[model samples]
Target: MTETKEWFESWFDSPYHGMLYQRRDEHEASAFIDKLFAWLQPAAASSVLDIACGDGRHAAYMKNYVHEVIGIDLSEQRIQKAQKLAKENLAFYKQDMRNVFRLNYFDYAFNFFTSFGYFQHYRDNVIAADSFAKSLKPGGRLMIDYMNVDRVKDQLVAEEVVEVEGICFNIHRKSENGKIIKTIQFKDASGKPYSFEEVVSEFRLPDFKELFERCGLQLITTFGDYELNPFNVEVSPRLIMIFEKH
Candidate 1:
């Protein structure tokens, strides 16, 4: 496969990518969603939007709370998988976050599980923030769950190897040029090889605050983890932010 500079297009769509991350704790994700639902207190008529919703897992889970949920992602494979689970109250779309999905359409928007910060250019991040702002109704809320760059840097693991379903996966991770990059190499039972890399920007609270301010969004609060504890730059595993449209 000819890989492009935009690595997510190839990496996220691969079956191996899904297999590697299949062990994510659904119970923990649901608990966080439940807590966020209580905090947002969305009404029955309110609509929810899930950005970069891989396989629509959280978006499907969110339908139990909101009247309607719409999930969007750049990967067609994930969207096709998500489509199987769609219901009257839940829907999925193949779309990019940097593009506007709908103007003033949703009351609540979520970018969960470190979905943001994938683009190579800083302006793409700004454009995504603006798109999120444009897609929300006035005073609408947005929740973004992202990795804490500082914590990730402090706990950096340079390399690791794992075997999944009889396939060997060699993983390498590093932080460079204000981004964290992970490269994965593996082979199938037939000895066919595959390789992919994931790159995420090292954005902090201040960076997000500036982006939000410029995009007509207000930074409401920041949390440290799925537990919704206060954010600490030095020790927090995640930087979960809640923002509102201004």
Candidate 2:
């Protein structure tokens, strides 16, 4: 597929994507990883892969626990920004998730903060899941942090305006075609208008189970939040799934 065909391809590589989500930087990543490591107790000698590791914040934090850490993202700009931190036992690469990387190499794989479900096609989603499975060793583990679909649909704000660095981002959201669609419109300092849309599939647990099982990943456990609370269909804010490769 061509890069231009996907919404994430353009927006994720753009400066606005970073600006709007600047608050989700290392501080948040560190907090989550701290909790994750404490609970999971991953081996210190394990190899880790951070999929869709925007700017390598999570991978950088995770390097403290693992032997080797590799971060990958489709965005060239993000990979370039992340590459500065590459060193012994840590590295960054530009890669598309639909394409497998370092087959059967990593002991652990992570897809954090709703990184999946960006593809518009079900086949593509399956391909991405297969890629994840292919990238891991037979007994490797994978963690995916996602939003609780029911909770998100219940609590979604229809519209909002966010001002960041002198730009007013007018946002609209709605669920249609089995996906949550968000539209962001803003103007630059020079009054240049720009618009972007984020579309993600509102996949529920069964959807994920089927998607992963087809790709050789078995669900292990699930959490509802960063603190690792039990999941609630109506109340939980996050759907964090842990899987193991067969």
Candidate 3:
């Protein structure tokens, strides 16, 4: 867990990281984000903070809906690309989500694309939650998009491979306790492999309810997908949680 940051930094700097998103199905991702924002429906005057905002795709898309959008990620390369592509209403910053940077400033905070999990230490996660809480104004909204752990566990595949933009990736998953341990290995055109492992903490409905309560947030809504559909153990591919500061 302690090595997670090193792993991410290395992985992000590798050629595979840039190529990975370039090859992703943009149509699907765009649809997914569109539905997500529709559900969020941020006020036009609201300021948004996007944590781990990879490449700022969501921030760029969100610019039309919000007054200002700030996207932060730990990867400098990703932030650089994001800065290059961002609109006037959107800005990208390189920062660790766990550390406190400034005061209460945002009306809404978003952690999308399963970006909440990764820290080796539970305290790190809590620190991040605290930072998020402190960053938001009173009654600010928080939207978290994470993997549907139960669904993923039940449908777990030992190994899978996908190819996009001339790059290939092999993904593997193993479940232990309430966590899914994932390894993504990327292969370039020459077949060289670069890999990273991520441990995702699994939380059930009650678990999230408790976690949010402990973090001084109230769960406003839960959806199985970006479409705002009711969530159940069997159907949804994602666990979208909407919370409000207490």
Candidate 4:
């Protein structure tokens, strides 16, 4: 069948996407969350929001720290799977990040693992940021973990092929017109071929600062990585930012 839908909507729902990223480190993710909790030290019964909570891995672990957790993702398949882990302290919903989510209801919000910046337009990104900000109460914080665009551009791999569980994925990456684009091509076990593209805006700190300020969020701090080291534009593997609602 010919494909016409937006890339993320189709790609993220594919079972192959999960398989390709199966090596994502759970221990590392948990450690990062633990460090965040140690630093933020939210109240024992604080309400937490996990934006783009794929498969609810981080959100599930969050139950150990926060009073309650709401995990939302654009992918219905992922949400359906994540729903199985929901308890009194945790819940999952399929939601678009651009829409308001229970305004002023959360004490802390998280957008982790470079999950953002998939939209084609800059305005959509701003809208998503605004939605996240509106979801938080005054004095609430939102933590965003994204790739260091400078570092990624400096070390961009033009092309590669990776095989996972007998499925071969041909990957191509490039920077064009202030955006980083990735194209993935692969075939299923039955020999059916498919292709998908991922587009991320080249959003730097200044871009984010502008968006946050417009949304009434004050930039609190920036970290280089999950361990919360100081951000270095030239060397940081990750750009971790914290913003507070004033």
Candidate 5:
């Protein structure tokens, strides 16, 4: 059987994807969320929306701070697992980022862990921005954690092989047409082969400002890493941005 869906539609749903990036677990998520909450000092009554909340790890931890938290992701498998973590004020849904889950509902919206820039179409990216802004209240805020385009381009490993749980994944990377492309090839225990491709747009700060501004989201602050350090174009591994809804 040949896989024909869009790369994200197929790749993100794969059990292997979860295995490959398993280290992005609750501990890592909680660390970053703690740093973020310390800086933001959000109100105890604030409501949160976690966009692309894979497995609801971040959203589950977030409920400890905010009044309530809703998490949404496009992957059904991920969302199913995330749903098990739901509680009175925590909920998970299989949802797309390009569509509004709630209008003017949340005090804060979080897009974390380099989740943006997945759509190959620039228009689709803009649509996602619109949804992000619309999900927040007028005085609400948005936090986006992404990879620093400059650093990723400079430090990209052209090729590598990683074995996790005895499954060997051969990875290749390249930059093309304003996007970073990663190709992952691997085989299962049964000797079945699989391949997956990941494409993320090379979105710089200026690019985000343009796309978000059009959706009434104003950039407020920018950080370079999980520690909330000032962004350095040449050095930062992560591009963490905060925006306010207008």
Candidate 6:
């Protein structure tokens, strides 16, 4: 837990941070969010909660469909950006999602784009899951979008480098103990570099199913991708799981 916290906080102070909702990946993110909302079918009056909601892109998108939206992230800078773009009934908070939070307030909750599984200790993941469960109203639904470990393993790219917005980044990945550990190095235009390694621990399908059950939720659906395709060993690029509080 300490390692994960330090790694994330280091990036929180940098401008080249919060890859999830930052503008660089907006198109891909919006496509995924469209599919998520279509499947969830949230009502206009439903209150939605987004855990680890980076820059609150999904929460902003949800404003068109829901009565209220709340996004929470650990990075204060990202939350401030979210708040600046907030509209009526949309808000953002900066807080650790693994602690006891204001309870039973949301009609639906979502954690998208492999946002879960950063904890160094297994108990930390459990604590975060419990916090998510407690944040929802009875019978509320939760959606978690994560990389399909099974599929990612099949297509593991040992190392790759790419340039986005004139910033060079390198990605290295390996699979161990049914988990993927990735190291990302970001270099500014001037060639100054900073690297962070993240271990996404024990996040295969069966592991997540067990966690959901232990948190008092029933698995409702598991899809291979954001498009809601049936999961198959050779076909899926992502894992999208839906759960309902029992």
RMSD of 4: 1.9
lDDT for 195 (candidate 6): 87
TM-score of each: 0.97, 0.97, 0.88, 0.97, 0.97, 0.89
Error of 3 at 64 (Å): 0.4
Instruction: Work out how many backbone clashes candidate 3 has.
Output: 0
C-alpha lDDT of residue 44 in model 5:
98
lDDT of 5: 0.93
- Per-candidate Cα lDDT values, in order, are 0.93, 0.92, 0.80, 0.93, 0.93, 0.81
Estimate the lDDT of model 6: 0.81
> Over 4 Å off in model 4, which ranges?
1-4
Write out the backbone clash pairs for model 6. none
Candidate 4 structure quality by residue, lDDT tens digits, 74-107: 9999999999999997999999999988999999
Q: Residue 148 CA error for candidate 4 (Å)?
A: 0.3
Candidate 5 stretches with Cα past 4 Å from truth are 1-4
Q: What overall lDDT, based on C-alpha atoms, would model 3 receive against the true structure?
A: 0.80
Q: What tens-digit string does per-residue lDDT give for candidate 1 at 1-246?
A: 974559898899999998898889999999999998888889988899999998988899999987999999999999999999998979999999999999999999999998999998899899999999999999999998999999999999999998889887999999999999999999888899999999999999998999888988999999999888899999889999999998
Model 4 vs. true fold: TM: 0.97
Residue lDDT tens for model 2, 1-246 = 655669998999989998898875566668888998887788999999999998987788899998999999999999999998888999999999999889999999999999999999889999999999999999999999999999999989999999999889999999999999999999999999999999999999999999999899999999999888888888999999999999
Model 2 weakest 10-residue run by lDDT: 21-30
lDDT of 4 at 74: 96
lDDT of 3 by residue, 1-246 (tens): 463254566776566666655656666767877787777777889899989988888788777778999999998888988998776768899999987555678889989878876666567677888888888888998888888887888889999987878666788999876567878988667777777876777767777677667878899888887667888878898888988997
Candidate 5 residue pairs that clash: none
* Predicted candidate 6 versus true structure: per-residue lDDT over 77-176, tens digit per residue: 8898889878778989988989755698888998987888987678889999999999988999999888877777888899998676777678898987
Give the distance in Å from residue 20's predicted Cα in candidate 5 to where it truly belongs.
0.9
RMSD per prediction, one decimal?
1.7, 1.4, 2.6, 1.9, 1.9, 2.6
